[model samples]
Each structure stands twice: as C-alpha cells, then as structure tokens.
Target: MYKETLSSGIIIVPMQQEHAEQLEALQRIVFPNLAEEELLHADQYKKHVELFPEGQFVALDGDKVIAATSSIRYHFNLNDNEHHTFFEIMGGGWFTTHEPNGEWLYGMDVSVHPDYRSKGIARALYRARQYTCKQLGLKGQMTVGMLNGYAAVSDQMNIDEYYKKVKNHELFDPTVSVQEKVGFEIVGLMKDYLNDPTCGNAGAVIVLDAGKAI
Candidate 1:
C-alpha cells in the first residue's frame, strides 16, 4: 500500500484487484501490437497481486490507471546456459515462475498509456522498483527491454549494432533508450522475445544494479 504523489498530480500506489480492468484496458493502448496470447487477461491481475503484491504498481490520475509495472522474483544468472525467452521467464504471464527466495527482480512489463507518454510516469514507476529492490535487499533488476521503433532500420543494421547504437546514444529507440537513461545496461539480446514484428523478434537483456540506485 505504498503511495507517492507526483508533481503533475498523478498518484503512484501498489496495484489492487480493483485495478484489473483498468490495467487491462491501459495495456491494450500501451502495447497495441502485442499478441492476444501474450497479453495478461483481467483475471490474471488478481493472481499477480496475490503472488507478489509488493512488486506490482500502478499510476493513477483520479480513478483512471494511466501507467503500470509488474515484476517477479527469480534466481537469475546472467551467464546461465539456459537461454530463457521472455515467456519462459515470466511463466506465461501468470508469473508462476516467481521464486520467493530469488536474487533478482525480473521486471515483467512497464506500460504507460498512450496519452501519458513523455510525462515521466515510466521513470517514476522504475524508481519505485528500485526502492523495492533496496528494501528487499535484492541483487538488482532485470528486464527484456523492447526495441521499439527498430523496424525502420532493421534492414540496415543487426540487433547487436542496434543495441550498441542505443547504448552509445547513436540511436533513439523509444523503449531501450529510455531504459538506458534509468541505469539499465544491455547484457545481450534474445530472439523471439515477443510477438512484435517491428523489433525483428528481438529484445535486449538489460540489468540495473541495486547498489548504484541506492
């Protein structure tokens, strides 16, 4: 039941079952290209809260949910041999993979409504994640960041080069660039991370150290 008020009057708080429908509606707008199978249905939100309520959060303006982020705990090793895809790591959207004694917070998704873009809502959600990591004494945070806006240049560059460009500030990927700004570093890329054709069926493995955030 954490709460914070942003300067713009948006309120950030732990997600509740009451927010399920609003969260599902916002997900449609925020991730319009996501496959139906990949999207979490409204009922799943209740499972998320029951499993790990502390890692689920939402941003609201009045009664409307404008942004949200979900995370799960997992014993992750960056050098592990198992080449887990996003779906495998997330337990098919139900997050049944969440391990109670895990070392890292695996960020499942961070979404902001189309109307709330560029308003710092996403960053605020990330800061909340960092706070959670610090409080729980977790190692850090991990995510498969979307390479939004990568389709336009996919024919001109490979995924690695595109990631480098985003890291070096040579490219302005809508998702990765913003993630890099918040301290996540690209460890590598994964194939078939999502159903989005725009990103060339790739996603970046990004990590942020909790000590640095603290």
Candidate 2:
C-alpha cells in the first residue's frame, strides 16, 4: 500500500471502500457547479478502488476526507490532436476504460475541500499520483485539468491566447497554474471538455514524466 504524511499533517493513502461516502460529499463541496452525474457518487468511488486501487488516492485531515484524486491507466499517446470530454473519459464515473496494460496514469479527478485549499493538500495529492505512476512502471501521469480560472477572463481573450498566457507565466489559472507549480507542464488545450461554466467548459492537458513523479 502507498501512504504518506505531509508536513502540514494531512494523511495520503490509497482510496478505500470506506472512504466512498465522504469522498462523494467532498465532491459536492469542491465542485458545486458541476452536475450530479458529472460528479462521482459513492458507488462510483467504490468501483474506482475495485478497478484500480493503486491508481486512486485520498487525503485526510483526521478522519475527514479533505481531498482526493481518482485515476485510471490508459495507453494513449499524450498529443495535441487527441480530444475527449470529461464525462466520456471517466466512463460516467465508473472508470470502465481502465486499461491494465496501459502505459500512462490518467487522472480523472483531483479535488480539495474549500477550507483546505492552500494548505499543501493538492500538492500532496499530486505527489501521491506521481508516486503511484512510478510504482506501476508507467510512462507518466496525465490529466485534463479544467481551466477553473478561465471564466474570469473569457471576454478578454480566447482560450488559445489565454492558454499561451498561462503557459508563458503571464496568467495564473487556479487549476493549471497549481499543476505547473507541482512540476507538470502544459501540452495542449481541450475544448468542450466538461459541463463547467466556471471554466467555459474547457480543459488543459497537463503531464509529468515518470522519472520526475516522485
């Protein structure tokens, strides 16, 4: 089993069946604008552990599920031409597309409770994902990060310009910028990525290599 305790006192561990309900509740708190179907309910969380326990993780403050990240192994080459929506990629929360022989760990979701946003919870969760990737001998960790800050500047620029600005360090995106801080890099942008008004329903594909996972 994989586990770690950050300096800030949060515990990171593999997601288990017992954590399902709290995780479901955590999702609502972190992403209030998303539809219920887009969020993984309790049953889906259990299925995630069942399908790929090694690829899923949660961060806890005491016994409360304060943060989590769900992932699946997939073999696709991380490229600019590829495209897929969050719902279709997540298999509607069931993670049915998890390929046992896949070469990459695909992050389906990573969320932190509002009260614990800047306490290193997200960075810890990401490190856990990278640790899992190296353990599985995967090529790297990949995620379609929702452009959570895009909505704030939508009228000022198009998604492409916004992407360049963020990539160039001229803009700060709540989600992507944080991922970059943790050593992931911007590779491409995804449009109509999810039903998220806050992000203009777009996503950015970010990646981190296996050698750098830990």
Candidate 3:
C-alpha cells in the first residue's frame, strides 16, 4: 500500500475496506449537495478497493479520515472533448468502469473535510494520485472539477461568465482553483455534467500530465 506522512502531520495511505464508512461520511460533509445517485456508500468503496486498491487514497488524522479520493483507469483521448455525466463516468460511484491497462487515470471523487481545509490534505492526496499514475505508467490524471464557489455568485452571472472569471483569477473556486494550483489544467468546459444546482450542473474538464514532472 502507498503511504506518506505530510509536513502537516497528516498521513496519506491507500484505501481499505475499513475506511469505507469514514469515507462515506466525509463525502457527505464535503459534498452536501451532490446528486443523490452520485453519492457513494461503503459497499461501493469496498468494491473500489477490491477493484483498484492502489488508485484509492485517504488522508488521515490519527486514524480519522479527513479526506479521500477515488480514481479509475481509462483510455482517455486528450483530443476528445465529449461531454459525460458524473454518474456515467464514475459507473454509479462504484468505479465499475475501470480499465486495468488504460492510458489515463480518471479521478472519480475528491473530498477534504471542512475542518481540514487549507492544511495541505487535498494537495497531498493529489500528489498521491500523481504518484500512482507514474507508478502505473499512465499518461496523466483527468477529472471534471466542480465549481463549488459558483453558487455564491450564481445569481449575478451565468455559468459561462462564472467560468471565465474563475479561469482568469477574477474569482476563486473551491474545486477548480485548488486543482489548478495543484497542477491540473483546464482542457474544456462540461455542461450539464452533474446534478449540482450550485454549479448549474457544470464542470470543468481538467488534466494533469504525469508524463512530465508534476
């Protein structure tokens, strides 16, 4: 299992069956408004560990799961900007679409507890994801970033304007901004991507090139 201790004193480790309940609770806290169908449960987490143990990770504070991320391997064509819903991509949150020999690592979920925000947990988990990508010789990491901050200013602007503002640094998004700061690059905008009213069901397709030093 992959393991590391961050300077912040948080430990990053591979996900296991024992972590499912904590992870499920963390998910609810991190994404309170996430679509019902897209929410994950303990059984799905166990299924993920059974399917791809190395691709799943959790950040711990003395055995407490403060953050977690789940990923699945897939053959991703960088040029393909086709739209896909969160449920479809995540295989109903069970990561049932994993491809053992796929070309890229697709991130299904990333969650950091509210109390642990800005303490480097998310970045650490992201680094762990990159480590797994390099270890598996995958091309890179890919994910649809949530526009978590959009809800606050949603009444003032449409998603397109909000996206442009976020991209230009005129605004900061809890998800997209953090992902960009940690090395992911926006490739395209995904509309109607999930049942997130806060983000107008929008998502940003982000990619990290593991072929390069990340």
Best by lDDT: 3
Q: Kindly indicate the candidate among 1 and 2 with the higher TM-score.
A: 2
Q: Candidate 1 on 65-149: residue-level lDDT in tens?
A: 9999999998888886256766777788888999998889999999998888788899889888888898899999998888886
Report RMSD (Å) for each prediction in the order shown.
1.5, 1.2, 1.3
Error of 1 at 192 (Å): 1.5
Q: Model 2: per-residue lDDT, tens digit, 41-131?
A: 9999999999899988999889999999999999877654478888888998899989999998999988998898888888888888888
| TM-score against truth, every candidate | 0.94, 0.96, 0.95
Candidate with top TM-score is 2
lDDT of each: 0.86, 0.88, 0.89
Poorly placed runs, candidate 1 (over 4 Å): none
Q: RMSD of candidate 1 to the true fold?
A: 1.5
On lDDT, the stronger of 1 and 3 is 3
Q: How accurate is candidate 1 locally (lDDT)?
A: 0.86
Q: TM-score-based ranking, best first?
A: 2, 3, 1
Name the regions of candidate 2 deviating beyond 4 angstroms.
Answer: none
Worst 10 residues of 2 by lDDT: 75-84
TM-score for candidate 2: 0.96
